[model samples]
Target: MCNLYTSLYVAISVSQHISVYSIGLGPTELLLLTLLAIILFAPRKLPELAKALKESADIIRREASGSAEKSSVEDKERALKEVAEKLEASEKQEKKKRRFF
Candidate 1:
């Protein structure tokens, strides 16, 4: 049980550190890490642990991408609104000019 937790912690920490620091580990390092995980944990546990981690990662990725898309849409809407407001102001100015003439 302790070994499982320790290995999982190490895996999560390594993943976070890699992403945060942009550490580039090649295929050999990844293979070694996978083998180390297998050595640390039961073979049967690996699939289940990998599945859980994959699901968690997917959820986080979807959420981040979704929020980014949402913000971009909001920015587009804001820009459109600003353009509309400027057009309306210009129309008012045109009307004022017509009334003056």
Candidate 2:
């Protein structure tokens, strides 16, 4: 139920033209959360946490894009294979017809 709600929330935010999401928070909300974090953590600690978050987000983005590219390439290869098989079958049929005549 919460997962569905998060998905819907992100979808709505995207349609409304917000381009950034930070761990389920919109920009304004994220700012508020950051303030709260500052109150809770040391200034030095905040930079370390931010660096780790940025690295993880980068890794996730890279993997997601890589998988999407791989899937598209695989789809194109499969389509070409199917077309080749179809052409080969058609050629075989034509050869059989020619042989009979």
Candidate 3:
């Protein structure tokens, strides 16, 4: 199948050093492909696309980090609140016992 051939070509290409023939295309082919893509997409469009991709990635990263920080803060607040409530309840019980005696 074509996939098998492609995988084998990739494996041989990566394992071997940069030579004249490594079963498939090489850096020259990559350069040609890049040039073709640039020609097709236009140089002006590339920067805009790259900037959009970068901004989207940054937004995703920032949101993930923000949510994680928020969750951690919430967890700490809940723990402290629970501890305070327990202490207050214990103090109230002690006061009641003292008054009863």
User: Highest TM-score, which number?
Assistant: 2
For each candidate in turn, the TM-score is 0.72, 0.73, 0.55
Tens digits of per-residue lDDT, candidate 1, 1-101, equal 67666656556554544443234766567657767877876866765666676677678778989999999999999999999999999999999999999
Q: Which clashing pairs does model 2 show?
A: none
lDDT of 3 by residue, 58-81 (tens): 686689899999999999999999
Residues 1-101 of candidate 2: C-alpha lDDT, one tens digit per residue:
45444433443433234235534656677556566655676665665555565666678778989999999999999999999999999999999999999
- RMSD per candidate (Å) reads 6.8, 10.6, 13.0
18, model 2: CA deviation in Å? 11
Every candidate's lDDT: 0.72, 0.65, 0.62
Model 2 quality (TM-score): 0.73
Clashing pairs in 1: none
Better of 1 and 3 by lDDT: 1
Instruction: After the best TM-score superposition of candidate 3, give how far the Cα of residue 38 lies from its true spot, in angstroms.
Output: 4.9
The alpha-carbon root-mean-square deviation between model 3 and the true structure, to one decimal in Å, is 13.0
Rank by TM-score, highest first. Answer: 2, 1, 3
lDDT for residue 56 in candidate 1, whole number 0-100: 78
Q: What is the total number of backbone clashes in candidate 3?
A: 0
